[model samples]
Target chain A: MNTAILSGRELNYQYNRSQRQPEGGKAALANLSFDLFPGQFLALLGPNGAGKSTLFALLTQLLRLQQGDILVDGTSIRQARSAALKSMGVVFQQSTLDPDLTVIQNLNYYAALHGMSSREARARSLVELERLQLGDAAGKKIRHLNGGHQRRVEIARALLHRPRLLLLDEATAGLDLETRANINRHVRDLCQQQGIAVLWATHLIDEVEAADQVMILHRGNKLAQNRCEELLLEHHCDRLIDLFGRLTGTQTGELTT
Target chain B: MNLATASYCFLGIFKRELHRFLQQRARFASALVRPLLWLLVFAAGFRAALGIAIIPPYETYITYEVYITPGLVGIILLFNSMQSSLSMVYDREMGSMKVLLTSPMPRSYLLLCKILSTSLVSLLQVYTFLLIAALFDIVMPASGYFWLLPAVLLASLMLCSLGLLLSILIKQLENFAGVMNFVVFPMFFLSSALYPLWRMRESSEFIYLVCLYNPFTHAVELIRFALYASLNLPALGVTAAVTAVLLFAAISAYQPRNRPQRGKPPS
Candidate 1:
């Protein structure tokens, strides 16, 4: 029940901000480490500039792991890249779907990439689209859809392969409050119903629930990692947002330990 | 990925490229117009000015229109391949490339599929141009048209590989326009595309050497000879060798650094 589907160990990465500076001045992610258990939702709570997307990039193999290692479904990403990649799905921060193509076309293309037959691709895509309440818009171009709809299409596309691990990097950014909450809650339900591990990265404090596993990330540092309620209890805080506020803003939220 | 998966991946990429090419009506128009203008207007003007000696590809003195048709074919291919790759740069900027790179296949295999797909689309455009040229009475030998198919596909692959390499190396989409100018223009102008090397040699020995050494010259020679029901061994060797090198380099360089910067949440 506690088997980890995703494991990131001592991961470190630096952005080369300038040509003259050899190895870069500041590290984007410095010695970060965590594990995401199967059927569990890991909320990576971090503000802007908190190395959330960098970590996501590394996990998705969009960026090379500069230091340490990452494993997906017991396969090291650095070693067996294709096998590791086969085990996960990622919905990046930006809209990655081609605007000119219809939603179904995009989903079909993704299915083909994973070697699914056309019959199977259609079946799986229809199931995901219906679940996302996007069945009617399947034939419409991505550009014709609104932001919330487009995002929903992306989520459907991501899940068509039924990967064991799903990684979303600020997936609900810039949406309205209702849409944001809906997307957040929907993704949370996926972990429970589908038995898929999820690593959801976001800055919004309210996106996380009191029962979820939350990790506070700031300036490439993991400030705290525990259940939401336990973190509030341990930090002597009334709510999750206060702990988040204290840790992320100003002269740091000094941890009791 | 397994062989079956790789084949499916290739089919997906091929269909997507063909779909995109078909959707963009203006792209097809522009691709045809560029070559047609050179063939109809430019070649027509230069016919009397540029006399052709009996080139090897031509057993006798060929009309200037016939001589330049193969070069015009080269133009369509060079521009089409580069245009296909320019869309790659656009995909990078638009973040669709990240989606592609993250697919459950080897990066090298994915890139290879992309090259083949674009080459196939470019082939369609080339054949369309040939059909239009035939309508205008600029016809090659009957068998030459059939034989030119393989040569055209090979040339398109090499040119597409070069374009893909440029797309990877070109960091910004804005920088790609400048690169196309530097690469496409010099390749077309300095090659045996427009005029015979002997003609260039007569004008300037230095210019002749550049044309002789330019890989585009060999590409054109291959197409020209193939269109005349003949074969050029040297051109075939050069094109095949260069395709291997460029393809290897492009696939190898498509690592982390070559990928476009992801839209981070301001970190």
Candidate 2:
């Protein structure tokens, strides 16, 4: 098995809304490149329109690669789709779980999508639910759960396949501070214990801990990528918010704490 | 596409659709109710006003209830197609469609799976309608039941493909009602659903030709012929050709990696 779980080289994408564009030529992502190794927790930080979602779409094969290539576990996403998807799991910025389905049902359905048998799916679902502390909410409909619990269920569902690489796009957008911290700790623990390569994408600087690898994106370009401590040292800044504001050119508002 | 993978994908989507329908029992029942009202009450009143005509599939004179059974079947398939497409739009809005589209499977196969799943659900609803029709003594020839399966399946595929094609072209759910008004009623009324093509000819050969060309007409004719264990070669050919065209068009519109692009912020 390849140690490098996810790698993208010179990825480029453009959207041609013929009516809006000047002759319909607008680039969404340009020459973006990055690599994620096993057991590494990488945080992708960018402004709202900095192409982070576009990058996520490209990595997950949700958007076509107009230029460049991506390989998941040594298999090109375009050429070896089934094999690549089998080795990777993705959680989009928006919720994907069916509100009508129970927590257990949602996980089982996702397992079935990967061709698992009903019995195997149920067993895996139980294990994932237990891991996320959602075992008690297994029979409850997803609509009944609070936003934080729903987000946890989504994470647990993604882990059902035991994918070597887990991609989370804005996984904690609306969670309260305590809930976000709990989920973050759980995810970090999972990466350490299971050695799953994680690519966590978010715009919030607070989400990046003192120790994870950080990649800052601006205008579809990778401006900076290094250890959290190193980035702060390079920028002569102690707080992540200050560094982020400097990198992305955004004004900082009142601090949460 | 890989047939084995396609089969698995089809089964997975089909099962999910079935679960959804079962969970939303009111919607399923209401879907059946619309056609039932047309078959029992509407057909009952029209039976007296409408004159009898000698159709090939009918050995002798038949009531309007028996005559419109196939059309009622078409109605179920048509409504189900629109319903499935509506769900697709909803899925796109809710982000579940992204999950299915992002799967390693080919886009065409994924779409075919969606069509097949919706077709199966439509067929089930048709059977439920047929059972009720039987209770009301609006049954066809006893042997017609077996042949009805293939006819229903074909019609379901054709309608579902058309629905899939529509979903790809229409980007938003708001545009759906306009599609329903402009497409659904015209296809249903302009075809031989409520009246024979010959009857349409008496009204106007131009209208009759339009009916002959319409795929919905062939779908209805195919079911009508099968209701008597007879085959309509022309209807079969037309239905098959239309299905192929629509499926091709649908698959072309859906690219696995075609994500919504972000635009510049408003000035």
Candidate 3:
């Protein structure tokens, strides 16, 4: 039940603000480490600029790992990047779909990128689209879809490969509360039913549940990591907002209730 | 990479590019018009101003239209290659490049496949321009058209590789217009594209020397020779060498290890 699907050890990342001084100034992620187990929904809670997307970039092989080891299903990303990436899927914070193409076309292109046959790609894309309730819109151009629908298409595209690990970098961003809740529920159901491990990066505290495993990242540091209830108990706060405030030294009512 | 997977990657990218090219009517029109303007208006205006000595590729005196057709072919390819680079920058901005780069295939193979697909699209544009030129009675040897296919393909690959290198060096899409002006203009003007090397020499020795060294000049000369049913060994050698070097440089620039902070969040 606790088998690790993804693990990173002492991961480090830096961002040079100025090109004139490329030497070094501040690190974006400082010696970060964590593990995600099969069928686990790890809510990677962090404020903006907390290096959530940076970490996702490294895990997805969009950026080469600089200073540590990242293993996806026991395959090292540094040494066996293609093999490691093959077992993972990612939905970036930004919409990556081509607006000019139909939803099915975008999904089929992604499936082909993973070397799936045309027939397999079409069948899988339809199944995923139907699952996302986007079956009727598959033939429509992405530009015709709303923000929530576009995000759904992106998610369906990501799952077409049936990867063991799904990484969502603020996947519910820019959606209304109801739509955000729906996406969250759907992804959580995927974790439970498909046994796929998920690492959901978000700044919203409300999206987390008391039973969910949570990792609070602030300013590139892991401030807290445990079950949500445990963290609430540890910080002696019933709400995650208060716990986040106490951990990060930020007093705000942004994530209440 | 496995053969099946490689074919799939190649075909998928090719189809996507083709689809996008077809959908953007303005882009297609501009790609064709740029060369047509050079072939019809510019060449027609310059016809009386320039004189043609019997060159190796040309057994006898040829009209300016025939002489500049290959060069105009080069232009179509040059613009298309740069357009491909533009799309690369746009894809990076849209975050779609992240999806592409994260695919299970080796990055180098995928990058090469992208260049090849762009070359294929550019090849189609060249042939379209040639067919239009043929309608205007600027015909090459019957067999020259077939022979020129390989030469056009090689030149397209070389130019596309140069564009890839430029895209890697360029950091943003908003700044690419400046680069296009800086690169595309200098390469087109200082090459054998608009005028022959002898013509350039008659104007200025230094300018002629620059044209002689420009890789685009060799690519033009290569296409010219092939279009006349003869092979220019020196031009072929030089263009091949430049393609190899530029391709290596572009691949090196594309290596993730070289740019640690490449996948920055969208602004």
lDDT of 3 by residue, B61-164 (tens): 99898898999989988999999999898887787888788899887788888888888888888888999999999999988888888898889889999988
Estimate the Cα RMSD of every predicted model relative to the unseen true structure. Answer: 2.9, 2.8, 1.9
* lDDT tens per residue, model 3, A156-246: 9989999999999999888999999999999999999999999999988889999999998888889889999998997899888888888
lDDT of 1 at A241: 66
Model 3 gets an lDDT of 0.87
Candidate 2 per-residue lDDT, tens place, B1-267, comes to 355545555666777898888998887898889889988899899999986687788878999988888998998899899989989988877877876866766667778878988888888898899999999998888888889899889888999888987887677899998887988999999998898888899989999998888899999999999989999998999999999998887887776544344344211
Report the C-alpha lDDT of model 1 over A167-250, residue by residue, as the tens digit.
898888889989988898888889999888899988777788888999888889898999999999998999776787776665
Sorting all predicted structures by TM-score, with the top scorer first, yields 3, 1, 2
Local accuracy by lDDT, each model: 0.85, 0.82, 0.87
Q: Count the backbone clashes (under 3 Å) in each candidate.
A: 0, 2, 0
- The window of 10 residues in a row where model 2 chain B has the poorest summed lDDT is B258-267
lDDT of 2 by residue, A5-33 (tens): 78888987776644356335566677888
TM-score of each: 0.95, 0.94, 0.96
TM-score of chain A taken by itself, candidate 1: 0.93
Which ten-residue region of model 3 chain A has the weakest summed lDDT?
A16-25
